[model samples]
Target chain A: MASTRSGTARRQYGVAALFTAPFFLLFGVFTLAPIGYGGWLSLHREQTDGLGLGGEPQQVFVGLDNFAQALTNTRFLGGFLTVGVYCAVYIPVMVAVAMVLALLLDSAYARAKRFFQLALYLPNIVPGLIAAMIWLYLYTPGLSPVVDLLDSVGVPFSLGSDAGAVGAVANLAIWEHTGYNVIIFFAALQAIPREVIEAATVDGAGGVRVAWSVKAPMIRGAVVIAVLFTVIGAMQLFTEPFILMDAATTINDSWTPSMYIYTLTRSYNLGGAAAASLILTVVLAAASFVVTRFSRKGATP
Target chain B: MSDVSTLTRPAAEAAPPAVTAPERRDRRGVPPLLSKGIVNGILLAATLWTVLPLTWLVISATKNYADLYQTGGFELARIRLWDNLVHLFTFGDGLYLEWLRNSLLYAGVGAAVSALISVMAGYAFDKFRFPGKERWFGLVLVGVLVPSAVTTVPLYLMASDLGMTNSFWGVFLPGLASPFGVYLGRVFSAAYVPDELLEATRVDGAGELRSFAQVAFPLLRPAFATLFLFGFTGGWNSFFLPLLMLSDHHLYPVSLGIFTWKESLAADSEIFYPLVMTGALVAIVPLVIAFFSLQRYWKAGLTAGAVK
Candidate 1:
């Protein structure tokens, strides 16, 4: 009997291991190992011995010097500022647009809600690189009807300028993200107890007022989730600016922090790139933690 | 019921009910017709914002090279969609077809395997009472928190060290380990697969793996479908990792291929412009169709990922 029990226990472990091996194996090798090696690489730099042109370089320990260098480098610092301006422009406009659309759909008077939802979400199906390329043509001076319309209307629009580059990238980002977030916000809005909304309506609250004071506050969790994910997505801003760099002259290679890290790898500065990657990760994780904490606090009360 | 209530009520009181309608309309401080117009007009504009670029892409694909720059986006003149498609397909000996095939192989195979692996791991975590189970799950949660873009460079460096760069394995293998999918898988497992059914199978003397295959997996089909659709879209949309991993133009995904063509537009706009416009349209069609068709799964997937 004891032998049979042991056999059953061993079989259980075997089956469990068999089921989970692929995920653990891939995650360990690809995700965990890279992170560990990245930490190791972040602390080391290549150095030449005496008159070294032909010999292979040695890996010398640099400690936190790479992080310090990344922090102080103007181009790298400028990348953060560029992303800062982008988030500043992007997050509010995107959340507002998505929230407004979600509210409109939730409104009693809105017709064909599913059609509006599906149409709004159509762009989210387009890949980011493709979306950026589509907008690139639209940002181009002569080929774009939008550009032509703005020109004919006596509005100066130049994709070559820095503001134009930022706006162009923001437009593409908003176009892709707004609808998906509208879905998120709409789901949250739907989860609200209808009685609460009815009660608010009975208290002389109008449609816009209920959307503001009642619905938005009730779905604060979804709003925070949306904001957190948007912030994370903003941190990984690469595709749009990278594609836009071809059309927008003011956009540099190191336009965003991720772009900066990519440029570092392209230049074979693995240590600096790893350090920048870690820095960005730590910052993003910390930001996520704070937002989660804030959301938790808001939830409790 | 309305007719019965009206018959039960006095005629004078019933007649006064119509006056309440205008008062109820005044409660919102705006007439219903005007507000409906305002709400749906804004929605229409927002939909247009989301959709006009796609419309432009569809329209621009039909224009020839000269007409692309000369004509407006919606202008219909000398439609050469077939000519442009021929150029796109036959360009550089059908490079676009190779890209389309590569994208399918990467996204299709990567998403299916990734979803299966995630479900398996999630099932094990839920079913087995292993020591350090929560610790193992925490590691996956950590993976979820750390964004993939942060890990792309280091993965690239390691892949290069393994002499795997510029190959399909370089891009394909890294995408398979989606920690977020695993997290979702766990949530789905708990929601979908009931333990009693597995216990009943155990009582029937079936082996654990066999029981899971026959009983649990079928029950978890919706979860698998959800994960697959999300993974498929994610794999199709991935840009940064593939961009860094593949240098061979033949191995480039459709997105990267379109990007390269557009990047060279300054040097040779005449040949590449219409090809890119047409290529963009072709690349987006399959994913759009898939999204609209299986939207039920994706909508559930989106809210599931966010709500938790």
Candidate 2:
């Protein structure tokens, strides 16, 4: 009897593992394994001698030296500052436009809400790389009719300038993501109880007033979530910058944290790359935590 | 599940479902309705702003290389969209077609396998009681928050160690493990699968897998749609991982192909601009159709994520 019971237990375990094995196996090797390995890599640096081709890179354990370098590097930090400014301008503009567009769609006069919703959300479905390429074409001098039109009108504009590049990059992101946020916000708005809105209207509340006090409060969770996703995404901006890097000469190797990591890794300095990513990961994670916790606590009941 | 949460709302989170009391109606009141025509006009204007770029893109695609520049931008004068496509497909011995083919393989198979794995794992996690589940799941949640792009180099290093870099499997394998998909599956299981039904199935001689396939999977259609859309979009849009893993131009996806085009275009600015425009227009077609079809799933998915 004991042997039979043990065999049944073993069989159950085997079956369970078999069912979940694919995800667990892949997750372990590709995701979990790298995270652990990245931390280890962060603690060591390579010492290459002479021409660096004839000799192998010697691995020397360097504690906190990478962190030291990252902290002290003003040029590296400029990447952070550049994106920070980008987000400071980008998020508000995008989210505000998204919310307003959603609200307009949510309004009764939007006869074809479904059509408009599809139109707004469609841009987001296009791959960022493709969208960037298309926009790059538009931003091109002779090929860009928008530029040609502006030039024809005597308002010549080049978006590749350092002054305009941040805005240009932000515009690409906005075009790709505003539709996504609009979809989320519109869902939030639609989720608002119609009867409640009707009641607010019956109570003499104007459209703007109802939006500010009633509809807005109800959709606070959606707003917070939209902002959080945007923040995390903006901080880790990659595709547009990668696609547009050549368009702007002023942008450096480390135009963002992820870009910095890419630079370090591509140069075969995996240790420093690992350290930079770790720092970026920790900072972004902390930001997510603070955003969620603070918003949850401060959310209107 | 979709309508229950939205069609009827509990008075409060702590309150049990009671008869509709209709308490505390907003007593303040609304302003008179604006002219309905004016409201529709404003909405129409917004719609134009929303879709004009895409419209211009389509129109510009039809324009030939000569007409593209000769006749100003965003016009109907240069109707060579078909010509532009020919150039795009013929460029560098037909690389664009390869990119399109690669994209389909990555997005289609990766998304299907992903949906299957995510649904099963999510169902198991939700319905089964096991040790170490919560810890493993928490780790997965962390994985979701950290952008996969952030791990590209590490993934590269690890893949290189195994000689998988520069291979198609390198791109396909990592996509199968998605934390967000698992979470969505869990949510779907919670929303769809009921304990009483599971108990009945178990009592009626259905084994666990049998019960799940016959009983739970059908009810998880919304979850499947959500996962499929997410995975498809992800697999389709994925650039950084593929960019890192694969180097051969033959193996390149459209994103990388476009990148190469951009680099060449930078070197020599010429009529390839029309090709790029037409290609961009063509590339976006399937995605736009995907939106129209999958748009409903997004609203439901977002509302679900928001509520919990």
Candidate 3:
């Protein structure tokens, strides 16, 4: 009986392993290995002897020198600062826009909520690269009716300038992401117990009042997660600026942290890139931790 | 068995409940606080904001080079949309078609395979108990937080080391391991696949794998659809990894292809502009169709993730 039960237990474990093995295998090879490799790469730099053309460059252990350099590099620092400004403008606008749309959809006064949801989410279906391309044309003078309209209104608009460029990119990000967050917020709103909402309604809470006082607080966790994702996403801004490089002169090869990493990698400064990546990851992780902790505290209270 | 029948009886009865709540609410005759006109106006404005760019894209695609440059951006000129489409497909030895094909293969196959892996793993995590299961899952949860961008450089390096850069597998392989998908899969499996059903199948002499395949998978079809849509869109929208892995234009997906065209527009604006605009429109059509047709699944996926 003991032997038979052990056989069954072993078979169960084997079946579980069989089912799970593929994910773990791919996860290790692609995810875990790169993380470990990146950490290792961050600590080393390529050493060259003579003209460095006669032989392969030697990778020497540098002991955080790359990290130190990445920290001080103005371009890298500037990229972080650029994204910082972007986050400042973007996070609040996106959150507010998404929340308002979600609240409106959840409201009794609204009609065709499904249509509005689909319409708003259309841009998100367009890849970030494609959206950026579309917006680039819109921001361009010759190709864009937007430019023509602005010109006719006697308002000069140019994505060529730094502020204009930032705003343009931010607008693209907002347009692409707001719908997604709206869906999230809308879902969270839908999950709120109907009795609670009815109670608020019975108490003569206005549509806006109920949305603010009841729905918002009820969906605070989703809101926090949305903000967290938006913040992380802002830090990893690549596709928009990468595509907009042709349209916006203000955006260079290293206009954001991910861009900086890409530039470094392309230039064969893999060590520096790795260090920068680790630093960026650490900062983001810290930010996420703080946000999670803060949100949890707020939730418990 | 008695408990199962008892639990299902109430659900079976409740499933056919009438739409009386809305009717009763209407009878209550409480006036809405917010004006319908104001709500509609706000919604209309938001919709316009969302739709206008795409409408511009459609219009721009229809315009020829001269019309594109000469006319007001929104004006529809002589329909050269066909001409643009022909040019886009025929351009540079039909590179756009190749890109489209590559994208379809990558996103379609990648999403399907990834979803399968995710579902299987998620099912295991849900239905099975083993040593280190929680620890393994915790690692996956941590993997969720590790931004894919942060891993790109390292992945590139690792791929290059293995001489996998510029190869399809480099991009295809990494796209398969979606930690979020696994997380979602687990959530879905737990929600959709009841333990008792699995036990019943097991008692009927079905093996664990057999029970999962025949009994649980059918029930998890909705979840699978949701996961597939999520993975498909993710793969379709992926740009950076492909950009990093692929240098050859032949391997370029539509996103990269359109980007390259946009880059060339600086040197030769007149020729590349219409082609790029047209290509962007064509490239987005598939995704737009998928989203519109499979919107419910997409919404379900998002809500599932959000709730978690």
A31: Cα error in model 1, Å: 0.7
lDDT string, candidate 2, A82-196, tens digits: 8788888899999888877777777755678877777777677888887777676677787686677879999766765766678778887887788777777787777666767
Which DockQ value does candidate 3 get?
0.47
Candidate 1 pairs with clashing backbones: none
Q: Against the unseen true structure, what C-alpha lDDT does each candidate score? A: 0.83, 0.75, 0.84
Deviating ranges (above 4 Å) for candidate 3: A1-6, A148-155, B1-34
- lDDT string, candidate 3, A1-301, tens digits: 2336667677878998999899999999898899899999999998786775787788899999999999999999999999988888888998999999899888888899889988888888888888887788788887777787889999888878888878888999999988898888887788666666676665566777878887777677677778888888889999898888876888999999999999999999999999999999998998888877897686555
Docking class of 2: acceptable
Which residue ranges in model 2 land beyond 4 Å of their true spot? A1-16, A48-54, A141-157, B1-42, B267-271
Model 1 chain B: worst 10 consecutive residues (lDDT sum): B1-10
Off by over 4 Å in 1: A1-11, A48-53, A151-155, A297-301, B1-31
Q: What is the lDDT of residue A24 in candidate 3?
A: 91
Candidate 1 - CAPRI tier?
acceptable
Worst 10 residues of 3 chain A by lDDT: A1-10
The fnat scores of all predictions, in order, read 0.63, 0.43, 0.66
